[model samples]
Target: MSASPAVKALGWRTPLLVIIAGCTIALLNFGVRSGFGLFLEPISIANGWGREVFAFGIAIQTVLWGFGQPFAGAIADRYGSARVLAVGALLYAAGVALTAYAATPLMLNLTLGVLLGMGLAGTSFTVALAAIARMVSPERRSWALGLGTAAGSMGQFLMVPLSQGFIAAWGWQFALLLLSLFALAIIPLSSALAGKAPEGTGPKQSMGEALKEAGNQKSYWLLISGFFVCGFHVSFIQTHLPAYIVDRGLDPQTGAWALALVGLANVVGSYTAGVLGGKRSKKYLLSFIYAARAVVIAVFVMMPMTQVSVLIFAFCMGLLWLSTVPLTSGLVAQIFGPRYMATLFGIVFFSHQVGGFLGVWLGGRLFDASGSYDVVWWISTGLAIFAAIVHWPIDERPLVRVAPAAVAAE
Candidate 1:
């Protein structure tokens, strides 16, 4: 009895703990921000400004998110995610809180655009997924990434209604201030995700070498191209769909619920894609997703506008939404190993944000010009097809640059 070994207790640094913390961070980061679309009408009217002002601020945010991701990711990859996440949470909270006081478009851009964008880059998918990827075994890596993604989608689902309630109860400004508090929650949770995998582990390739290798890979660029479409589709729909629904004479609440449905369905879709990515070909699944997106968007546009149609479209689109994330990140980890996943995936994510910038800003511009979202809708459809076709040619196999001995040395 005395000789019997004591079972090991799970430490705070355990993979499970890391994943739980990371997922919670994802939830808060995505959840608090997902409902920004709901603010467009109220905020714009309050400022006596046109939609472009708000849209431009959001567009700047999108681009800044992309621009900051690579550097944030590189820092996370080299140092650790905890510090990056902590700093991001601070920026996120400050941005949201300060947004309540913004009186001009310039102020809006500074708070929402630069601060919020930078915050999201640190707390969003690339950083979280890369951390989870390194924490779990390869066999469970994809599944864990999906779990993290699903957590983020859950936030999107749950937070939109809560955000709406906040706006309904308080004014929009106070609502923003209240939500800013939620962003601060990420600070404590970031502590559990403190380990840095790249300092001494794995291949000793410099960041530049890793970038060079990925740059030479055709599949990597294909993934980037396809992900850009995902950004475009998501940003456009999330930021403006509520207005679109209102324009169609539907209740604004209908638009909110529609976005929530997308988030809810995304939980299922993201988890399923992650599990499937572990077993199936990531490229084929991606191709199918993009192709399906094109068909879904086309059908939704052609159909008459109704609350039911919008809800249905949202659900369908939600299933395809963040589902691309786990698979795409998995492919990056699969091809490159988990060493520099944050840096590599961050670069891919940058392209996505670029698309997001275009999608959101152009939606406002085009709608303002044409008095209809028709042109943007068609552009989205065409981009979906392009993404679908591009994913088909990606070589899903892992890259092998050196002999076995060299790899062992690495």
Candidate 2:
């Protein structure tokens, strides 16, 4: 069908609107997740719980977030990002409110684990990026994905200090309440993602089919394995960096600054990565990034534990942070097609969260048992190197060719 005159005139506007909505969603979901570290000390201390108890909540959150993601993505793919996001905002708000009052481990687990994790599944980058991918042309999708992820980092940059200040001024519960309000803000922004269907379309693939397809792909397994390493590295650092700094006799504020700096620097790194990934082999770029992280960690650990060294490490490490996301997601779209991008990507992300659960939970447990994080840090460094090696030979082309059989089956 020919374009309507009104639609033709607003050519660039549609893509721009989607990109803006994508970035907004990214910022809101990630900004809050990024600040989870700040609540660790305060919440645990207030409740007189062991660090592992709170870590358990975070671990539960990670695993459940992974578990819930594909279903959320399927819902978004089937219904629309708006409806999924609206529901996520409501769940996130309720979870945060309940978290503020959580006195028992079971309560913390329910609030942070089931509720908040599922909320993230619905409203987080997977759904937003899929929506943006569908809206943009193939050529621009990589860079567009990068911008969306960068926006998430920018959220981290904005929210870390904001969270810290809230904790200082009002208290942890109040701070959580403030963030809950921010989560609700996604409601209005979600309207920007609303749109009618394109002309006559065949039935969409069911979520079960997408999951089954992903399960059968060799490349998908590779992606999931590599992403596991990413989750382990990222969650370990984000969840424990503050405590690590405090344990090392540095001021707690420095840890917050380190996290914020990482977020600030990641904005640039993610954008540059996106642009580069579009032009070059995204798989190789991701490998190089993972390798760079290992080198950075080794150097950081070898250096004297001083303020300047920590900051330098944080900045260098931040540049490598989330650079994998664009390449990984791009690979998923490349191999699986965007028809079920969110659901497939959600399956891949599930591996990441599994690793995240292990990373955060083990970080706390090992610290309590051994009184040190050396083993976990070294283990993370090794996994990064292993992941870099694993990504070296990934064929970027589509894994399963859609032949007549596939089309008819669909």
Candidate 3:
């Protein structure tokens, strides 16, 4: 099929607009969600619920977010991202607003878990990056994705403190109401992503063909497996690190700042990963990132607990945190082509969220049972090593169908 004249007419400026809009959406979506950990203690205390109740709600949120991603991507791929994002914005706002009234575990799960999770699936990196991927040239795609991912980190850095402040002044429930208003901002931003998927220079393949091809690839599964470790590490730390810090006799503000530092450092890490991915071996980079994560976690666990150590850990882990995102998503695009980038990446993201579900849930359960987070920390360190090993053997070449016809002919 010939490229549309409109698609052909889209230039660098168009992609810039798309990237800006995408980054904004990512910042807001990820930013708000990242702060949920701050509310863990307060929300639990208010309802006289166990930590497990809050953890389980967030775990369900992670899982549902994972499960919803591909469908959201599929819908965006067919109908356009704007509609999906619009619906997501509404759900996000509603979920946050409704959570204020959630007095039971079941209600919290329905509001925060299902609604917010699905909302994030539509508005977060998976959908936004995919749309940006379709908008830019292949050479520029990695960098664009990195920017979007960094924007989420930026959101984390900015929003965590803001969330803390809100909770401090207005209380958690009122803070959520304020956040609900912030989520509504995505409605206007969705307009920037309002076009059909750009026609690519490569041969066209049906969505079914794309899915089947990805399913058959060993490297694809390997990527998915590695991503699971990322989800596990990140979800656990984000959800529980603040409480852990507080339990260790530090101020709650220290924990909040630590999370903020992770976000701040990750902005640089994510952007660097994106830049390097365009030129380097994404799989090797991914392997190195996982290995580094293992080392960092090991060091953090062994060192005496102190404010200095906590901040250092947060910075180091922050640098490693979400750096895998660009490399992983870029690898998918590199292997499968951007035609199905959203759906394919979403499938991979589901694996990550499965690990996330386990991570968040297990952290709560084990901590409740053993009265310490030591077990989960050690487990994360081990999983990082496992992920590093898994990523090392992934074949990073593009699929034959997506390769240039000359290369395919050879």
List pairs with backbone clashes in candidate 1. Answer: none
The lDDT for every candidate, in the order shown, is 0.90, 0.85, 0.91
RMSD of 3: 2.8
Candidate 3: worst 10 consecutive residues by lDDT? Answer: 4-13
lDDT of 3 at 303: 90
Per-residue error for 258 in candidate 3, Å, reads 0.7
lDDT of 1 by residue, 1-410 (tens): 22211112224477777889989999999999899999999988998888888998999999999999999999998888999999999999999999888899999999989899998988886798888887667899999999999999999999999999989999899999999999999999999877676342454678899999999999899999999999999999999999999999999889889989999999999999999999999999999998999999999999999988999999999999999999999999998888889999999999999999999999999988888998899999999999989999898777765655786787
Weakest 10 consecutive residues of candidate 1 by summed lDDT: 1-10
> In candidate 3, which residue pairs get closer than 3 Å at backbone N, Cα or C atoms, i.e. clash?
none
* Superior candidate under lDDT, 2 versus 3: 3
Tens-digit lDDT track of model 2 for 51-168:
8988889999899889988888877777778888889889987887789989999999999778998888878898889888876667888899899999999999999989999998
Number of residue pairs clashing in candidate 3, backbone atoms closer than 3 angstroms, sequence gap of 3 or more or interchain: 0
* Model 1 quality (TM-score): 0.95
How high is each candidate's TM-score? 0.95, 0.93, 0.95
Q: How many backbone clashes are present in model 2?
A: 0
Better of 1 and 2 by TM-score: 1
**CA displacement after TM-score superposition, residue 210 of candidate 1 (Å):** 0.8
